[model samples]
Target: MSLAALLDLRGEPALVVGGGAVALRRARTLLGAGLRVTVVAPDLHPDFAALPVRAERRPYLPADLNGQRVVVAATDSEAVNDAVTAGARAAGALVNHAGDATRGTLRFPAAVERGGVQVAVSTGRELPMLAQALRERIAALLPEPGTVDAWAARREEAVRLPGAAREGALDALRADIRSAFGLSAGGAV
Candidate 1:
């Protein structure tokens, strides 16, 4: 599923099952989106202690899944990760299992940010390596932040135009944006 389908995690209870670098990255991402995160792991990076998050220095337990909207399992131990995934699933919370996308309820995507727009791409556990590569290429081809703003500004005007005229106007705007970014015709970033 696309990240857009998930509800905004703001103010939601989220759990991370590790305190390592991988888990830290996930925690930072969730925190950036305004989730109330709780990290459960025996050890934590020193930098993590400075972050504004709840930390529990203990092995993960089923109780950790309580009241969580999302769960991320990034622990070093595969067995623990599996257990966390299972527990989160049993709780009906969306879960992302690091390095085990097939077993998790959701997979995080590499996102491209353009002004207020965020484009996220996923391979559905089929080709993550390819997805990463495509993400880099898409990042390179994305128009400047101003272009996105311009597009948003023109959206209302386009909607006011007649049907065919609207399509043509949007097409022209898309072409101009793509050309400004040096992208080929019919190729989307």
Candidate 2:
């Protein structure tokens, strides 16, 4: 079964077991999510220089997964990726295998974010192109980055109201959203 979830992995530690293009992409995404990522590979990719990651230009060690919250097995060798998967399992960390998604427990879905709001689409990693297309469509429909921020600021004041006052404020906010986003009175997004 596939479940799509938006996780707050900020300040968590993650490990990438490769230095190739796939691993580079995974590392960037992890960093973007505010993870403290460490990449281990025999030859660190030159592109990793710009990213804020602790790069170790050495072969992967099972102990590398010791304190990682998430792991990505993106090494070139299938056997090595399998080893990384085993290590992640032993360390009780979520693992994602780049070469074959089914072997790993986690799937990185197509995602878009504006302020604190995030939308993700996943086809169980079976049809990535479709997921990408859906993500693109959704991205185009999103409001500007600070639009959600502005709404959240208003929400902070609305929640402070007492009893029925709070309900009224919230109702107004809902109507504002519907008006701004061209949503129906039924509250469909």
lDDT of 2 by residue, 1-54 (tens): 876677889999999999999999999899999999999999988999999999
Kindly list the per-residue Cα lDDT of model 1 for residues 26-111, writing each as its tens digit. Answer: 99888988999999999998889878899999999899899999999999999999999999999999999985888898777777
Q: Please, what's the RMSD in Å of model 2?
A: 1.9
**Maximum-lDDT candidate:** 2
Question: Distance from true position, residue 102, model 2, in Å?
Answer: 1.2
Please estimate how well model 2 matches the true structure, expressed as its whole-model Cα lDDT.
0.89
- Per-candidate TM equals 0.81, 0.90
In each prediction, how many residue pairs overlap at the backbone (N, C-alpha, C within less than 3 A)?
0, 0
lDDT of 1 at 16: 93
Best candidate, TM-score: 2
Regions of model 2 farther than 4 Å from truth? none
Error of 1 at 69 (Å): 0.6
